[model samples]
Target: MNRRAFATLDRPYKNKTTLDLLNSLAVMKFSKIKPLVSAFPTLINMNNNAVNCLIKKTLFPVFCGGETIKQTIPTMRKFRESNIKTVLALAIEADVDELERKGTDAVSYTRKMVDDLKVCIDGASKFSDNFMAVKFTALVPPGLLKRWSFNLKKLQDHFELVSTDGLLSRSNVSLVQDAFPNLDASIFDKCDELSFSDITAAVSIFGPNAHQLILNDPLSVDADDIETFQLLLNEIKDICEYAQQKKVNLIMDAEHDYFTPAIDDIIIGLARKYPQGFIYQTYQMYLKTGFERMKRDLLRLEKEGVAMGVKLVRGAYMDHERHYAKMNGLASPINETLKQTNDQYNAAVEYLIANNVPLFIASHNEDSIAKACKLIGPNSNVRFGQLMGMQDSITFKLAQGGYNVYKYVPYGPVPVVMQYLYRRAQENREMMNRLDKDKRYILTELKTRSLFK
Candidate 1:
């Protein structure tokens, strides 16, 4: 490895303007205080014009792409200059809370969100090698998503919840009695006696074809949830189909565990249709079962002869997940320590590389990245990703090394995207040491420019 490629002062920071450095410095310093981190959402919601202006002028410019598609063009162009592509995410489109706030207008709001995403697809199609993130949270009710997750997890005891690959290729396809080969059909017969409800019982909840269902089972079903669920499925299909028509890739982001199983089901089902890396599923490797999930996905995809499009992230919901598990009296799903998370994340990275899987390694950890760089050959079907405004040095370093890299650029109104900013702050608080290193890098660059002179 070229040591300078991993160095902090490797010229990536050298081009940052004084204002940009100052903004990063402010955010980094603020992240060190736990109370402030906890109160970040409240502060953003205070609704004061002055504070919002300051944030817009300072932190917003540094971290976010912009509030609109037009605003994000500059960000995309700037990153393109660095040999980086953009993963444009519409932060406002999928917030369930915001949709709830729209109460009387909820239906219209959801439609508008979907339309906005269409606009995003149209805009993104103009740029090659760029992708967008889609979350159907606003389209599907959160509580219902959780219910599907619970119901599917129970069903998953027999097989993973996704409809198997190749569900789209054949014309005379028929639903089967078993999704898993050799797993006795009798297992589907043991619903009532198990006490927690079996596959048959799930038919009442998810509808009749539940026996062959993974989480998203049955091409047709008679159930209330399935009806609403079909709306969400239709929306995703329409959106993704349009994207594919326009020749753009769309990444399906992973959400909370309570909602992810159903999302996973839908994503994998779509992955079967959009199998040329046009649709990617994200795997957050902070959870204890992270490695297992990737292994299962890889195995199934290979067995079914489907292409893989994976984005391995270090995870963004550590605090939220841990708290949810604690309050619900469940085992914390997160790894017990940072080292464990890094280990699990790296293991998943190694697993993908070993399988020659097409992947996007999205992390800020240099050691993990260096390890990936060392393990994979030059022609590997691998790319790199890091969030915009975070990890500039490593991102630039990887791009400089002739690797395909993307900056995850989030865009939405400042107030509407507060949850995202709060997560970024929480991420910063947890990564105090990393923030210190970034601050040092900025300070060093400032000194090198000699504004003091």
Candidate 2:
């Protein structure tokens, strides 16, 4: 191994010049709008065959390793030789039945991938850097989980209401309004004849005696909702433990605020159980409150005496979150401006490094990556990560500069690949109104490459 590239580490990425350049580029308006206008239509109609065609041809090649395991090999090999780590994910997201079907598919696919990567790692110990990443929503439907959570809250509120008094007060009405804001006027008119228990029984979707309602898409087996989630956890755990034996990492992708706490708790529990090798918990830096949340988690972890592993992202669901909040006249989770997000991202990176916690700073932003590299010192555990296709220049250059870097390499067929593609397109478009640094960096790279020729 040529250690020369990895040796000249300190004082290499620390200069403030590129950071300032990035700041100027990031604040410009036209650089942001161009990509937005181009990406919006494709994003809005993600299900369109034409869009899928484009995704398969252009974006997939850029953002994903490939559509199949065999296809991912070459890309994986290239990264392996370069000493860049890889996190392979079978990109699948759909409704309940489809998600469950794909969960089985993922298990089968991951086992094969694990076997292959193990061989590669064994053959060339320092070469292969492959791990597995999966989304929770890929194994279970998001809406079903949402409905389950909603029903649970409703039952709790009803319990409180009945225990208080015979009359339903404003707070109890608020609870009902929160769950079913579109409650029928006719339903309200008939409430006068119903007692607390009668109303509770009437409102119950699965009858009052049952502790929980059947999820929108009920499980085929005797697996309860939490049990089903536990099964998913067990599958990932089985794979993670196997991979750990082979020196591979497993990461859980983050979801929306609604379900993230449950998922976070699960990941944290796993991290505690397998502290030496298993690292979990993901952070979305694009959220307005992301920094605060990270700080809170850091304190909690410190108090609990557990190591924290995080996969940091600029987030992808800002538009949908904002749109939903605006429609419902509520606050959104997204940052107020691009500067705020970038600042927090940088701060969070610094925070992680200061605590000496291992982190994966998965992003395409040059300034953010540069800042992280500077903060990492000579030999640190921070890894720079990027999606396979979107920003190879940064990924390659950072890896070339001797920092540990990883590519989020996703693989699967077209149908399952669509969800990953949709998110990539949406993320690019959403950031278009926010950050211009990536576009500007690309333009600079193109100019430099032309000049070199």
lDDT of 1 by residue, 201-277 (tens): 33432233533443344422224555556444556567878888877788888788777776666666676677776
lDDT of 1: 0.70
Residue-level lDDT tens digits of model 2 in 187-274: 4354543333433334332322223333333321122544444334555566557667766666788776555544554565566667
Q: Which residue pairs show collisions in model 2?
A: 62-389, 63-389
Taking all chains together, each candidate's TM-score versus the true structure is 0.83, 0.66
Residue 400 miss distance in model 1 (angstroms): 2.1
What range of 10 consecutive residues in model 1 has the weakest lDDT sum?
A: 166-175
The lDDT, on a scale of 0 to 1, for candidate 2 is 0.59
lDDT (CA) per prediction: 0.70, 0.59
| Candidate 2: segments with Cα more than 4 A from true spot | 1-54, 95-127, 141-144, 147-223, 230-233, 430-453
